[model samples]
Target: MNVLIVGAGIGGLSLALMLHKRGIQCELYESARELRPLGVGINLLPHAAVELNELGMMPALAAEGVETSALHYYNMHGQKIWEEPRGLAAGYPVAQLSIHRGVLQMKLAEAVIERLGAGQLHTGMTFDSLEQDEQGITAFFIERGSGQRVSRRADVLIAADGIHSAVRRHFHGEADQLRYSGRMLWRAVTEGEPYLDGRTMFMAGHQDQKFVCYPISEPLRRQGRSLINWIAELRVPQAELPTTDWNREVPAETFARHFDDWRWNWIDIPAIIQGAKAIYEFPLVDKDPLPRWSVGRATLLGDAAHPMYPIGSNGAAQAILDARCLADRLQEAGAGAGHTALELALREYEAERLPATAGIVLRNRLNGPEQVMQIAHERAPGGFEHIHDVIPENELNAISIRYKRIAGFDPAMLARRTTP
Candidate 1:
């Protein structure tokens, strides 16, 4: 089957690799004129790490990212709420990764080009539209800047475009799909002394007001230096969404005042905020889960399929999972299984993953595993003397486990599955 994948982000590139592994011929059409290392850090939970390991890219990933050792959550007063060993430390065979999202994308794109060769992955081609017939599918594209029209035919078209997916918008365009949470985020990386364990990921505060920090660079970690990726989020009173892009730079003075009193004994929050060279502001928004992802020979993947809030560290992880499942079902259908076989495979992939991710989308709105912080704040508006007094041990454990299962990264369940 000649599969056409749209967008060459993490999801699109990973889908290319997975399909190639399944012995299927596929091509990727990316809108960007050039694939540059863009965006900031993101976490790769254990289950998603296993998928990349199977693709034989773990060594490359480990080189660019930190092998996260633990995850810690604290309240506004710097009091510990819940802590857990993560990645291999948590007993999963593979290690969880905290890498720059852009670096990971470039790594995956390079792997795709290496295995599939040059022309298979095309850049400068923007997806304009597509038409599916009883025989196969034909997709139209235009050069990004020059507007040179191009058309290509394939057995299926898979949309792996990011949150603002043109293909998804073309199909599911409605009044107000991108639901704003009234919270805005300012994200940037600061080169500073590593706080806590250099490999630890931590978050302080609740949904509305939160500060998340983690080290991303491995070489810097080895040198006793840290490229600390931090996001300072606040509940903006804007009923309407801000005109923001992931790369739009902003002055820290905009949101730094709200976190002026955030410094504690172990970590100095103000210094980290001021140290960042540039900060990009983005809204904390997500679309309501779609009722379906498959239509004829075309289907959605990654953010295009389900753009959930970045709670519980499941954004890229879920996309990797979706790509793997789609590849598996497509491989099962066989190369010469024909168009009917392709449609069935798409539906099967949807049936399994659509509902699963939809649940996560809704759950993320409720704060997912991070709900513990919300619960803590609701119980004790003032700082807690003891976290147990505010929330029980069983309740804390239950909340963590429930989100793990919902996000499909419960280490106990993952232990049952074979790793690459």
Candidate 2:
């Protein structure tokens, strides 16, 4: 079967690799003419790390990213709310990696180019539309530089395009579907001394105002320093969403004041804000889960399928999982040159993943595992003498475990799934 994948981001590249692993032929087309190591850092949960490990890319990933050791949550006063060991430290048999998104994308793209052959992956191709009959799906793309149109036919078309996906817009229609939270995020990286174990990820404050910080560079960590990736999120009063571009740079002064008093004994939040060269502003928004993600010979994956709030650090993780799941289903269905088999396989993939990711979308709306912070804030607005006094240990543990299960990374569940 010839599979056509749109967008060379994490999901699309991962799906291509996964398909190749199963000996299935696939081609990748990305809108960006060049894939740069852009964007700040992101955390790969243990489950996602395991998937990449299965693909035999963990050594390369570990070289580029730090192996995250733990996760912690704190209230506005910098008082601890909850803490848990993560990745291998948490006994999942894999390390949760914290790597820059652009670097990871480039790594995945490099793999695609190498395994799929030098000329297999194409950039400068922007998806326009697609049409499928009983035989196969034909997709349309416009060249990025020239006014030329390129067309390709495949047994199935998988749209792994991101949040602003054109293929998705084609199906849902361009009525503006992004649901903006009142909050906006300013994300950037800072180089400084490492905090807490040199490999910890931490978030302070509640949903309205929050500061997240973590080291993301293995090379820096080895040098006894750190490259910290941080986000300063604030609730914006505007009803309309600000520019949702992930690369839109803005002044730190726009949202730095909210975190002026956010410094604590261990880490200084204000200095971290002032340290960044540029802060990219993006609205904390998500689309309402679609009624369906697959239609006939075409289907959606990754952000195209489920764009959720990045609360639990599951965006890339979920996309990797989707790629694996879809590839598995197609392999099971014996997807061939026949479009009918591919369609059935896509529907099966959708039936399982659509509902799963939709649940995460809604759960993240409620702050997911970070709900511990919300509960603590609501229960004790002034500040807590003791977090346990405000929110019980059981409640905190329960919230974390529940989110892990919902996000498909529950320890027992992963063990069962990974068991040969």
Candidate 3:
């Protein structure tokens, strides 16, 4: 069976790798003229790390990325709210990874190209539309530079095109709208000395205005220069969202005001903001979970299937999970039964994932893991003398546990599932 994957971003490329591992023939089409490394840092929790380990990419990833040991939260005053061990430290079999999105994409893309060969990946092919029948699925495309139309037939089509997917529009129609989160974010990466242990993922301040910073590379072990990735978010009045392009630059001064007073002992927030090489702004947004993702032989995956707010660091992780699950189901269906098998697998995948992701979407908006800091901020109104005085240890632990369950990274869940 032949599979045609749309959009060569993290999801599409990961899907290709997973399908290839199952000995399935697949081709990936990307809209860009060339596959360039893009975007900032992304976190891969233990759950997703299992998938990467299965694909034999974890060792290489570990060499290029920081292995996060814990996730720490702090109040706006720079006081530590809570810190919990993560990944192997948290007792999971896999380690959490913090790496540049481009690095992750390049690693997966290179792996796929090496295994699947150069002919399988077609760049500069813009998707126009798709038509599906009982026999197979046909996708129409245009050469991005020449504007010439092209078409390909495959047993199944997987739309992993991301938030602004054209394949999603072809199936869901034009009415699909992205919901705004009333928050705008500015993100940038700077070459800098390591902060904290150089393996910690840190979150500070409040939802209206917050700073999440982490190291994407290890400087100590290999003389590699550590890259610090930071994002500043602020609550804003509803407005049209910015284009979803990763490289769209926004001035650092626009959002730096929120962190001006963040004088923390671990790191200087304002200084980091002022020193960033470039900053890009994007409104925090997500689409409501769709009722269905499969329409005959064509189905959506990743952001195309369910675009969730990027709060729990599940954006790329969920996409990797989707690719693995779909590939497993397809492999089970065998060669001649591709269409029927893919549709059934898509349905089952949606049934299992949609509700879980919807819960995360709402939870991230309402109370994610950061709720501890929010509660601490509210109870102490003024900064606290001690964290215990603001909230009890068990209560804080409960909040973290709830979020882990919702995000599908709790120890119990991770323990039950076999790696890969």
Candidate of highest lDDT: 1
Among all windows of ten consecutive residues in candidate 1, which has the lowest summed lDDT? Answer: 238-247
Q: In model 3, which runs have C-alpha deviations exceeding 4 angstroms?
A: 219-225, 238-247
- Per-residue lDDT for 4-82 in model 3, tens only? 9998988899889999988899999999999887888899988889989989999999988888988999989988989
Task: Report lDDT per candidate.
Answer: 0.91, 0.90, 0.85
Clashing pairs in 1: none
Per-residue lDDT tens digits of candidate 2, residues 97-146? 99999889889888988899967798899999898788888999999899
For all candidates, the clash counts are 0, 0, 0
Tell me the TM-score of each prediction against the true structure.
0.98, 0.98, 0.96
Query: Per-residue lDDT for 110 in model 2?
Result: 88
What is the total number of backbone clashes in candidate 1?
A: 0
* RMSD score of candidate 1 (Å): 1.2
